[model samples]
Target: MIAALVSAGAAVPVAPPGLHWSACASGLPQECATVSVPIDYAEPRGDRLDLAISRIRTAKPELRRGVLVIIPGGPGGSGLNRPSTYVKKLPQSVLDRYDLVSFDPRGVGASSPVSCELAPADVTQTAILPWPGPGGDISPTVAWSRRAAAACAKNGGPVYDSINTRNEARDLDAIRRALGERQISYWGVSYGTYVGAVHATMFPGSTDRVVLDSNDDPDPALVERGWAASYAIGVEDRFPDFAAWAAEHEEQYHLGTDVRGAYLRLADRLDRAPLPWPGANPPVLDGNTLRSNVLNGLYSDARFPQLASLMSAALAGGPLPPTTAAPEAALQNTFAVLNATICHDVSWPRDLRAYARDVAADRKAHPLTAGMPRNVYTCAFSPGPAEPPVRVTPDGPPNVLLVQNLRDPATPYRKALNLKRALGDRARMVTVDAGGHGSYLDNGNACGDAEVTRFLTDGTRRDITCRG
Candidate 1:
């Protein structure tokens, strides 16, 4: 009767407004569609923008329950490639029961992509990461952040202002409506966990089953800056995992057998005398660059070997590994959105003297990350207009499931527990005795994956404590 009334051209209610899908350029089984959402939800009828959406339908049509939307990490992360990644990891039961959906959030990949056109010198990991100079000088990063923020404001257009967690959550709902579903399930990781939490709170009834892996503190006041500050402790907590690995394989890659001391000393040594290498941007491998690379590799345990090998080669004076650079346009888009989303999400501390004091203290306390963790991003200098952060509380449906590693280098266990406590009876917390950025399929923790899969499939919940 509802469909009849709508199709008969009568004023009727329906979702997704107007959705048209066809073959996606990915050449995979996934079909892609463009969704239109208000640029400003406050003025829903004023301006609209396209949101790129993709879906991989279930093989068993009869078993299809609803949609499972996978939210990607990073203020700049893209989810369009997630279907392919999930094909290998998600259990067959999940594949049969739900149509998997993922999207590149607003001002991100293929969807009114945002760009700042930041200088090439400032684009690489070391430079972008805010590693201090020998004098512990972070003035450059502050200056850089100011300029980068201005560049984004200039090149990013209005869409840059539109890129944020809340808007992204709104975009997910728009996608859900487009798919003709009254409610949707979510699996969000790292930064996505925050996104999922906000979505659940904002549209409590619209969220069915939510799995927030590697959760962040939704302490509305701190927001992403809290996540950034925790890296000091986060890196401290997880560095032991890397240290233990280095200790076990001392013979293979011997910077030293001292586990932790070796990497530190090597970093110090490299800082003074950086190794000259060919084909690398800035054309040299300095201590800061090496540390930045190590930080990136720690996100996944599998990358440890490559990171260790690089350290060994550099220490042993062997060949330099090939360095790949993303096209300038792509890099600009990523940084632009990253800056816009982070700066626009919440206000950050702007006092330069305070940062200096914190940096000095952090460098002394957590040498693993140095002062980089507390270092400013573009947010500190150019905290663009901030949306009131969504206050996450246990006011929604009791359908949230949080999976977190005990020692995540980015989100950390303590932060996860904070969120878990905030959720109270509305969610179940599953703790994994592991060390990595992502907890489920990305890590080899079978228990964590099983818990998540069971929750999604059976609608069951129990707080689980599992082995790595």
Candidate 2:
């Protein structure tokens, strides 16, 4: 069965011209394909999985320096769709010089999927993620964690235990080998930054040029804990952007001329009586949803107006908008995979009391985010066996360039600073004075984009910081 699966995956299909590529919402054409990789690297001769890969070939193939692999954020986010969303955003010169490639990592879209088969009620976005209650009460969080873990344990197989960053990095190397490339270039955003960092560390010789945007702290000691706690700082760093937007559109949003006052007013009202959001789990607006929406909005400033409008309607005592739902089959599987990968990658503190104490403190320090940052979730519920964590150092060749947003919410500047320090002479950092998740091509200044394009296309980088 393993040999047959491997042989089947090894076969690449041919595409027929125009139908092979299409424009994404970002207005870029993308070509798609599938790359077969071993599900378990240790058992390379065994069963294999298919990874859905996408590419937007360079406009001028003659000028192409090399392939630029894009690593998507989220142990869960799919990169299979990004080449289309991002191809047009690339500077023409960059597009003219390199093939933009991306893939959905294992346990993701079109990859050999693994599902926990959780019930809809058991896996509602809020319940599955475990946002702590107001005032840091985690009784409900504990209950949900146990239930979710049990469901996964019963339904998830060996594949569940196999999902981890180290394995994902290994899969990436396999992809590189299959592409017949001696060395590959990279552009990683958010969680993808961590993936790029690990890949660079694990197989430094296989890397040509690398870019890590909106970086994460590669602290082996606390991985997810560090990422979660960073939210307090991240929210503080990015709230100014939202504040400015609210203030700018005060007439339209009717929140307030003062951003702080407006935010406080909204928080108070939501705490007292959250507006009804049809189809939402628990059936009403709450601090967690509000917090989640705030973080989600920070990923792109364009979403700010939507958030403001929602807040305005809620303030007017109107029914909140219906909650957005994806196919449960897909989300449950993705969420389960994300949990397995995160939990299996590192060992988390198992003490429930410790989590409670930390969450309490976090709530006090950052009320806007509440205690969700420190709340217990499935990651801590059923952690898999520990694996060696990858250490990203600055010993590699100086082919890496990093572009970062100073005010990113998901991946804050402080964490990027840590990554920069770790990379040392191997990388040159381009700091964009912007607010949002990704910096390069998306939400990044033209100067920053040009600098990255030049680096990716011509192997030239500017040793300068961009303010605005």
Best by TM-score: 1
Instruction: Give per-residue CA lDDT, model 2, range 1-468, as digits (tens).
Output: 111222211112222222233444334467666667776778789877777777888778667666788897787888887777777577777677667888888888767788888876776666655677655788888888888788888988876767888888888887777666667888998888889888988877777778888889888777766887888789889988898888888888888867655665676667677777887665677666676777788888889988887777777887676566667887787787778877887777778999899888887788767777788877677865557677778876776788888888877888878887887877888989899888887864878888887887667875677877
Residue pairs with backbone overlap in model 1: 16-177
Q: Could you tell me every candidate's TM-score relative to the true structure? A: 0.94, 0.90
Cα TM-score of candidate 1: 0.94
Highest lDDT model number? 1
Candidate 2 lands at a TM-score of: 0.90
In model 2, which range of ten residues has the least summed lDDT? 2-11
Error (Å) of candidate 2 at residue 36 is: 2.6
Worst 10 residues of 1 by lDDT: 2-11
Give the per-residue Cα lDDT of candidate 1 at 60.
92
Each model's RMSD to truth, in Å?
4.4, 6.2
lDDT at residue 251 of model 2 (Cα atoms): 82
